[model samples]
Target: RAFSLNYWAINLGFAISSAGAGFIAEYSYLAGFLGEALMTLVCAVLVFLKVPESRPEQAAVKTVGGKRPKDEVRLTTVLRDGRFMGVVGLSFLVSLIFQQGYVGLPVAMGADGLSSSDFGTAIAVNGVLIVVLQIPVTRFIQDRDPRRLLIISSLLAGYGFGLTAFAGSVAAYALTVCVWTLAEIVNAPTQTGIVVQLSPA
Candidate 1:
């Protein structure tokens, strides 16, 4: 529930700041960035003040089937595991593609002469679609095997990037963003779940 709380807090804080900015600033972009920075600072302060460490002391020493290993599971062991390393590598590549598309999109749309409203509309569409589709799509795929889901999600992510290569308008860009956003929703939760499952018993 922390994730949901944090998400709502950030969104509400930014919305309020943006509304205030609309009254005080001539340009929306600068106002938005200022709002973001201020909100980030506030979040940092709250985290520093209120958040407690959640790590469990026995996490590394879990005994499986009555056998206690000589050594505790360490960060280095987790990082060195081949499967875990593969997940980290895949996650890095996914993040690169996601960030590049997210950042490059505005430049691409602007180069095509799209206005601020058009870009904002594209983002709105992305947000709306993600909200409406995420749960239903996830529920439909919930019963599928995790490995297959991972593979399919990866392919969908690649397809999203491939679509971006050909996007010439705001609508096309929005479509690509939706595809990638869904891929992210599918991939992220499953990966995290698997990581938790794979932790030493």
Candidate 2:
């Protein structure tokens, strides 16, 4: 539930920012940048005012059979956990793949004669889909195996980008975005939940 809420919040922010940035950039790139900076400043102030530290009182405790253990959790111990390291590595690879939307997709679309505004509109599909579908998708997959969901996510993400190779129009690019956005809807919350599960008590 926590992870789902976090995912929803992220997508909500994305939707608003992406759409706003598109319109703002049409007027002036400098204004768009300044607006973003102002929003960041606002968010920082909100966090400082409203957000509380959530660190556990016993930072070094371990979990045994879903119960807390008294042992201290060390950075060295976390680094030594092969499973955690593997999860982290896989997450990094997934992030690299996802970043292509921001870095490579716009360039690719521009090369195909699309404008920056067009790119923004197309990419906004990602945020829109996540905002609309994240909760339902989370509920659907919440009871399923995280590993299986992640595998499906990996495949979806791969094929989502792969389909771009055949894209020649904005519609084609938007379709590709839809495919990967679904993967993100499935992958993000699951990844966060997994990390929570893997963390020490």
Candidate 3:
């Protein structure tokens, strides 16, 4: 959920920065880069000032001898868990797919000859879809099996990306993005919830 929130903030910043870039295009690519830099700096400042540490209060407590609470199990013991290894592998694969989308989409859009306005509109559409649908989708799935949702999300994202590979028009690309956004809606919350549930006691 925190990851989702950070992703949301960055996307929000991107939308604002992209609008700034559209206006600053009269200047140069340097102007747009500077605008993005400014936005990133602002986000960094806000996070530093406003975000609180989430570490457990118990972690700050000391024993009578002044030693902090010690781990009962060794790192090697935890590392021996098969489920932990599976989770790590799944996490790596998911992260790879997620980052690849970010890097690959712009290249695909540029190749398809999308204008600035069209690209912006498509992204805005994606944001809007998430904002409107995410809550209802969460409510609908709250009582259902999360693993099933995760599998479905993977299929949706795969199909979405496959469609994007052949997209020729702005509308077609937007449609493709919409499919992936829905997948993300399902993907993000379910994975996060699972991670929290699976954490060692």
Candidate 4:
């Protein structure tokens, strides 16, 4: 539920910004860039005002019980954790497909004779879908097996993102984005939960 709400809010912001960006860019890229900068500043201000500091209230100390407790979990310890390493490796693979959403998708669409506006609208579908489906989907999958969720997410992400190669029109590309966005919603929280479990407490 934590992860679901986090991403739900993020995608809501993305959906609004992405669609608005298209119209803004159509007039002036300068204006688009300025708008992005302004939004960033607004976010910073909001965080400063609303978010409490996470730092512990205790006074700073060089050691706990005369020992470096933080350093107890060493890099070597994490590297030697095979299960954690394996999951991280798999996450890297999934990220490769996701990276294409912002990187290769636009380039490929452009090569197929689509305009910048078309790409914007198509990619916006990704954010919109996440906003709509994340909570409901997370509710359904929250207690299910992580292994099964991961497997299904990987397949859905692979198939949906891979289908973009065959997408010729904006609608077709948007459809492909929807497929992968569902995968994204599933994979994100599931993968994050797995990593948290594997992490050294």
Candidate 5:
């Protein structure tokens, strides 16, 4: 629930800011940059005032090993955890694929003779679906097996983007966005839980 809320806020801010920046840029890029700077300053102030320091209490014992002795989470412990590192490796690969949503998607659509507006319309579906479905989907998956969820999400992300090779229209692109957005919705919060379970205290 906490991670879901965090991700929700991130996507919400992104959606609003992206739309606002587009309009602001139409008038003046300098004005858009100044506006962004002001918003960033405001965010910095809020975080300083409201977000508390989470200094996870750690014992002074400086032991180095693959095994964590009881209620202890150190850098070496996390580094040595085979399962966590494996997930990190796989996540790197997934990220490589996901990045194509930004680069490859636009290039492919442009090759298909779609305009920038058409691409924006297709990508907007991602933010919209995430905003709409994140909370409900989080509720549904909260108590489910995390390993299972991650495996499913990974496959969903792969196949969802894989289906993009066939998209020649805005609607088809939006449909692919919907599929990968589901993967993101499931993956974001669930992956956090897995990390905490396998790594954090």
Candidate 6:
């Protein structure tokens, strides 16, 4: 339930930001960037003011008592964990693939003679669908195996990007976005949960 809410909130932010960026960019790209920077600063201020530190003094004291290792050694231990390292590598690959939506997709659309706004609209479908579906999808797969979910999501993600190769129209690109967005809806929370499950703490 916590993961579901987290995923929902993430998508909600994405939806708002995607649409807002599009509208902002339509007026002035520089203003859009400035607006994003301002919003990021506001979020940082809010976190500084409202969010509590997760690391407690007790944890530091326990570490001093040899219940926990020093930071450098702890990082070494994490690096030595093959399973965790594998997960990190997989995550890196997935992130590289997913970033194509932002970097490559827009370029591809532009090459097809589409405008920035059209690219924005196509990408906005990703945020909108995830916002609408993430909670329900999270609930449905909450009890399922994270490894299986990750595998399925990875496959869907690859296939979704593959479909983009054949895309000729904005609608086709949007369809591809929908495909990968579902993969993202499944992947985001599932991956986070898996990381938590795999952590020593």
What lDDT is reached at residue 145 by model 6? 90
Model 6 scores worst on lDDT over the 10 consecutive residues at: 56-65
Best model per lDDT: 4
Q: How do the residues 12-121 of candidate 1 rate in per-residue lDDT, one tens digit apiece? A: 44434433543444466677777769978998999889999787664556678888765766787787788877877877887777665547766777788876655565
In model 5, what is the error at residue 109, expressed in angstroms?
A: 2.2
Query: Model 2 Cα displacement at 99 (Å)?
Result: 0.9
The true-versus-predicted C-alpha distance at residue 168 of model 5, in Å, is 1.9
Q: Write the per-residue lDDT of candidate 3 for residues 1-201, one digit (tens) a residue.
A: 455655565556555544455446545768778766987899899988999988766544446587645654457656776786677678678766755455676678878877665665555556666666766777777778988988888888888878878888878878988888888878887888887776566
Q: Which stretches of candidate 2 lie over 4 Å from their true place?
A: 56-70
Query: Which portions of model 5 miss their true places by more than 4 Å?
Result: 20-35, 56-73
- List pairs with backbone clashes in candidate 3: none
lDDT of 6 by residue, 1-201 (tens): 688687788778887778677667778999988888998999999999999999756533345566654543466788888998889899999988899999989888989988777887889898899888988888899999989999999999999999988997999999999999899989989988888888755
All candidates' lDDT scores? 0.67, 0.87, 0.71, 0.90, 0.83, 0.86
Model 2 lDDT, residue 96, Cα: 94
Question: Better model by TM-score, 4 or 5?
Answer: 4
RMSD of 3: 3.8
**Candidate 2: worst-modelled 10 consecutive residues by lDDT:** 54-63
TM-score of each: 0.72, 0.89, 0.77, 0.89, 0.80, 0.89
Local accuracy of candidate 4 as per-residue lDDT tens digits, 1-201: 897899899999998778777667778999999878998999999999999999769655578788876656788889988999999999999999888899999899989998778888998998999999999999999999999999999999989988998999999999999999989999999999999999976
Clashes of 1: 0
- C-alpha-based local distance difference test score of model 3: 0.71
Kindly report which residue pairs in candidate 5 clash with one another: none
TM-score of 5: 0.80
